[model samples]
Target: MRTLHRREAAAALLALPALALGRPAAAQNSRPVRVVVPAAPGGAIDVIGRIYATRLSEKTGSPWVTENRSGANNTVGAAEVARSAPDGKTLLINADIQLMAKRVMRAVPYDPITDFTPVARLATAPLVLVGNPAGTPNGDLGALVAAMKAAPDKFAFANSALGSMGHLSTESFKRRAGLDTLVVSYRGTAPALTDVLAGQTALMVAPLGSALPHLRADRLRAFAVFSPNRSAQAPEIPTTAEAGMPDLQFTLWYGLWGPKGMPAEVVNALNAAVREVGAEPAIRARLTEQGADPVDEDAAGFARFIGTEAERNGRVAQEAGIEPE
Candidate 1:
């Protein structure tokens, strides 16, 4: 009887963790999955997050909702997700801002690497240098560089978020080009684009997808694309190298992450759902049209990629002399 009692106690101890999780398994199926986009509605991250949520919900028979928690260079929403329970319900879908927030900010509320588990890399798109044709003299990279060098603090660069790809990539470009262009931060992409269109800001480095519509409508003109090759959606635009800023190459990438300590099985399921969505013809077509290249990395691969990206972006930030806020 004594031995049986000890065995039963060990079994209970083993089951305690699962019991304490309060339906971690149910999160994958029964409950709604909330994907948190740490930006305003019109940004590239928000656009992709909505697409993924809609497709994943339809594919998996589990409702997925996108919640915008924009502010503080993405920290406000990130911290909220970080502090959430580690069940699969709450997730984060963001861009390179995830890796850059800590490197560019003075006091980050959550650890970009340790506070979350990377679930999968969804897609990557080149950052395009766009200018309002009405404001820019030549509407080309060489002219823009020359203009910045000629007039210090005369031109303003607009960024949707403080630590976003637009911010980091523009800073790096400035450092490399030996230019002193003033950076202007806006609440989100919509406002930033509005200012750019209205000629309030001279230039903006943004995700190709976010700038595509304006470029097509002639509201904004593409100067250079920050990729080794021109994007399929806008092949007429020259690469940064061809446009005379060879070293200013940067790509905007998006991925999914859940709060730290989420179960491996749940992570795997989410990754599989993303892969399935990527395989759909319509989804792939839409992503391609938006200048994104679909990626199908699993959870472990995504984690490793995030680790490397954080290290690389930290080095870039240090090199650019961008002091944390």
Candidate 2:
């Protein structure tokens, strides 16, 4: 009995606040609430999730910790959350990729909308079109488009994932520019950027935060930013509107969510916590450093926005002939 008790205690220590180890918010316990980031650690969403979790722990007097569950373009983590108890103990912080699972892949496990409750929109980052300096002519978008149109068979774009903001936005841009080129989907951004830097691919629409350092280091060239105005980090770059691609409009946003059927009070409390964290100057500064604009929005508002975005993206994918894989 003594040896069995020791083994059980060791197992409990190892599980120290990960997965769905904690009880529901209604039935509180000493275990910490797990804030799941559906992406690997040290990535954009993981960084933001950690920041929010740290602040939420202090703000709500509840121990909150971040847990990573990355795979299948967020399907693995999202499905796990959908199956978890609709308690406040397990939460999700994911990017706009949350809505694109159905449109991009054929074997998604859950409905992105109905399986989860949208809590609040945390931040948004502008997407920029970037190309290798040596790969394109004279670092100009017009020149690149002309050359791509002239020889449509040679050039292709690289996207980090199938349903990522980078992928869909680039496809939309290709359609708008009237180019019939291939878009190679890599497993992640680092590998895709590697190919772009090596001229294996011609261009990619990446989040400003991910591309800014490379652009600053002279490793890549900026063709356009998919926004109304220039990014303050790279003010020298022109907007998509300025580049004469005004039809391409998209922003990479991060949001908070939980399993469906969570109590309204729990959802509202989490939403309020996000807003309070968003309003902090320190938090805003951190997000700004990451090239994101923090946003303040309610749950219902975010839900409506998700519906609109999903519909638009689905239409765009269909028009671009992006079939599920």
Candidate 3:
């Protein structure tokens, strides 16, 4: 009995170091993590958030749940996360929209660059220019551009919302391509795609993952992708440069963020967890299959990337002629 007691005490002592580090113990004992995704469920951002949440729960042995607080081009949920206690319990999973919100909105409650500490950049998906095949008889980009130039006001373009990446990318395309496509904004990607399918909207620049199904079904036509190279998922679709618009580049990127002042230990632990999970072959393959390239950047690296993105996207917003609303 004495020997058994000693062994038990030793085991508990061994766990003390881990508990102090706050990896498995903190998450397990704390309230369930609330991951806020500033977009509607079923969109690419939401899907990526769910994946990371599930994997994070598995890694830390904690229950992580996602809450959709979509509105104001992703500012609503972002603001919520920003206002949350910086205990690492509440997190935000968002994309480029977070950076562009300030540029296009008259006033955003939270400063995306300073209000949160970046944890990791999960994945990035290139945007694609798609249209209804029936409406766009010429499937190539050049043909589509010529058609739009021929009759500028006759055709309409759709985007998720005014301050969204879709909106920014399309606006940039119009300016760069010199096409006078009218803008049609929707509450979310589903409605925007719905309008496109119904032919109410002629074209849209959206994430390739969301548009892949329709493209496969032949309901929509993919003219060009915005990436520098053709996507493995859809090699048939040429790149924008190949289609004569090399300067047009926009990618839908997803990253994790916590309220400002989260402990460095917690941030480091979460960053390591994301990188470990992202390195798994199965997860990598799955993200790739969905037209996303999983990125393994840490907190500092992601923060720097966000800075660069903000600067570049700011230029995009200005050139798009989209005034703050």
Candidate 4:
């Protein structure tokens, strides 16, 4: 009995150092994090970033600051984040434009996959096809397709920018319908939608959130929405699949990312905080109001999703023969 007791005590003594070492590491807390918004102020990305920053700060007991660094189609801000220290103190909040930028531009400074690590996916907003109510045959998707096909080169589609989500969706629609519509690129969605309203342009593909007011006012007619499922806010509008085009699966999803080499513990901490924020009722409500659906995804899943998006955009750009602006 004496020998057995000694052995047990010896084993307990050997475990003390590990327990002591583990406690300090586990107790370590992160400092305030800075979230970089890769767009101008008053944009959807900025709004989402601010909301996420506020919630993450509250949940982690660490301040989160949103910094807008807009330029170069979000490449300037993304590059800044990629060059920042990988200590979890700096994060990037952006949308699908990042992937399309890489696909269209040949002079990107950093690699999209290698320079940063995905932290989490926050939300997704679907795109909708809208046309001026005062215009030609445009009551439904089939009518619009028929009009575009009949005119071919005369029909024009407006887009937010040269390589934006709106541009890609319009291009995909043209390809799917085997039509030859002229693509008119504007500086932003507001200008493009303005042109469509003023009868300057015939049609456009814009975010459902941005088009909701116009749709409700009857200024624009929504023919189809680009999403895997129908939107709850606008269930009357049919999805692209129901419109007979299942290949048009696209959404403007927002996510968080950090520079490469971020520590595993820090990544885990940020993921937990983001997931909590996404699951909150207030956050979900805000997202719904913005025409965005909250999506809870971890680092690994988001990273994989990014990879797939990059590849898919690349293929689409190639097929469209899109040139950099």
Give the per-residue lDDT digits (tens) of candidate 3, residues 4-98.
24444333223223333555664455457789998877778887788878877766667788999888878889999998876667899988787
Q: Residue 208 in model 4: shift from native, Å?
A: 1.4
Residue range 75-111, candidate 2, lDDT tens digits? 7888888887665677888898898898888998899
Kindly report which residue pairs in candidate 2 clash with one another: none
In candidate 1, which residue pairs get closer than 3 Å at backbone N, Cα or C atoms, i.e. clash?
A: none
Worst 10 residues of 2 by lDDT: 12-21
Error of 4 at 312 (Å): 2.0
* lDDT (Cα, tens digit) per residue for candidate 4, span 49-134: 78888876655445677898877667888899998877667799988776776666778898877888888888889899988887
Highest lDDT among the candidates is held by which one? 3
> How close to the true structure is residue 56 of candidate 2, measured as C-alpha lDDT?
69
Off by over 4 Å in 4: 1-32, 152-155, 186-191
lDDT string for model 1 (143-225, tens) is 88887788766678999887777887889888878887789998777788889989999889988888899999999988898
After the best TM-score superposition of candidate 2, give how far the Cα of residue 320 lies from its true spot, in angstroms: 1.3
- lDDT of predicted model 3: 0.80
Q: Ranking under lDDT, best-scoring first?
A: 3, 1, 2, 4
